[model samples]
Target: MSRYFLIRIGQSLLAIWGIVTIVFVVTRMLGDPAVLLLPLGTPDSQIQELRSSLGLERPMIVQYLDFLRHAAVGDFGLSYQSFRPAMEVVLERMPATAILTASSLALGAVLGAATGFAAALARGRFLEFVVMCLALAGQATPVFWLGILLVLFFAVELGWFPTGGWDGPASLVLPTMALGIFVAANITRLFRSSMIETLSEDYIRTARAKGLMPRTIFMVHAARNALIPVVTMLALLAAELLGGSAVTETVFSWPGVGRLLVQAIDSKDFPVIQAGVFLIATIFVGVNFLVDLLYTLLDPRIRLGR
Candidate 1:
């Protein structure tokens, strides 16, 4: 198990390195940072001076090496737009994004699992069909459009929630619902399929044949086994949430890392952009690594050293 963990850690490090390299290259490719930072009619000489001051005058390889060196020591450089440490800016908004992601994930998991479980038990019934249809529609709806509609109804019409911003708990309801609903739809489908398969297994049949209570047979025997795949889906869902939150955050005008990232991109703030991408990638890699470790705990048959 220790060996397996070490291997996973190594892979995660490699993945982070690749992400860092890609972000660096792509941000540079966007255009000269000096042009973005300076005024519209800035003189070429002034731009060169600005580039020199910012170390953009150096060779691409040299600049990249410097970036990697600073990043290794947790310095992502000063933001071109904010003139503050890039990571500091990212961290300031991290909590809002964390809260949004957590709320959405919890809401989605609960709703999806309950609905899917019900559908599985009521297979071929009207309730099951209704649940399936709702799941399909949820999955088909775009998150941004859903967010807008939610704001329109809940905030604009009913005034039950704030239209945008992360002012308080009430402010979170609409955005979380928009994001959660989409995630829930996907999870419902996954859980339904997994539960259906588990229910058809020989163990489940034996449990039923032994006259186990229906609830006990379904929840204890079937659901527990079916949860492995559900857990896997949850992990993947976390990564997707991180990526998808950019659009959601923008739509809601929530002051999160995702919203900050969008702001950085719009202003061509290379440092902040690089830091944001790097941080998100690191989280994605870390979550997947943790999920890999969880597999062993979930299923003993998944021996690590195999």
Candidate 2:
């Protein structure tokens, strides 16, 4: 088990390195930051001076190596926009993003698992049809569009909640829903299928034959196995939510790491952008690592160190 964990840790570190490198290279490709940073009509001399100061004047290979060196020690320099440590700025927004991610995941996983299990049991019934249709619609809708629609209806027209801002609990609703609805829809489909398959297995039939209560047979024998796939899906869903939060937060004006990254990109804030990507990637990899540990609990037959 220790060896397996070490191997996974190495792979995760490698993945983070790859993601950071790709983002670093791609960000440079979006054009020189010095040009975007300086005011329009600024003198070329000033722009050149800024570039030199920022080390943008260096060769790309040199800059990348320097970046990697500092990044290993949790330094990404200062934000071009805020003139503060980039990681600090990103971390300040971390709690907000953490709230959003947790709320969204909880909403999605609980609702999806329940609805999916119910749908599986109610297969061939009207309830199943309704759930499936809603799931389809949820999956089909884009996060940004849903956020807009939610803002329009729930905030603009009805005034049930604030359209944007992170004032209190009410502010979290729209963005969470926008990010979570898709997660729920996907999980619903996957879980429903897994449940149906699990229910048909020989062990399930044996439990049924042993005079186990119907509820016990379903909950104990079927639900646990069905949950394994949902657990895997949840890890992937978390990554999607992190990605989608950028759009959702922008639309809703929710202050989060996602929104911070967008602002960094708009202002050509390279350090903040790099820092944000690194933080998000690290969180994602960590989540996947935890999910790997969870597999043992979900399915005892599976061993980790094999």
Give the per-residue lDDT digits (tens) of candidate 1, residues 17-81: 99889888988878887888788999999999999999988999999999999888778889988
Report, for every candidate in turn, its global Cα lDDT versus the true structure.
0.88, 0.90
Q: Compute the lDDT of residue 100 as modeled in candidate 2.
A: 88
Question: lDDT tens digits, residues 89-203, model 2?
Answer: 9999988887888899999998899999999999999999999999999999988999999999999999999999887999999888888898899989999999999999999
Model 1 whole-model lDDT (C-alpha atoms): 0.88
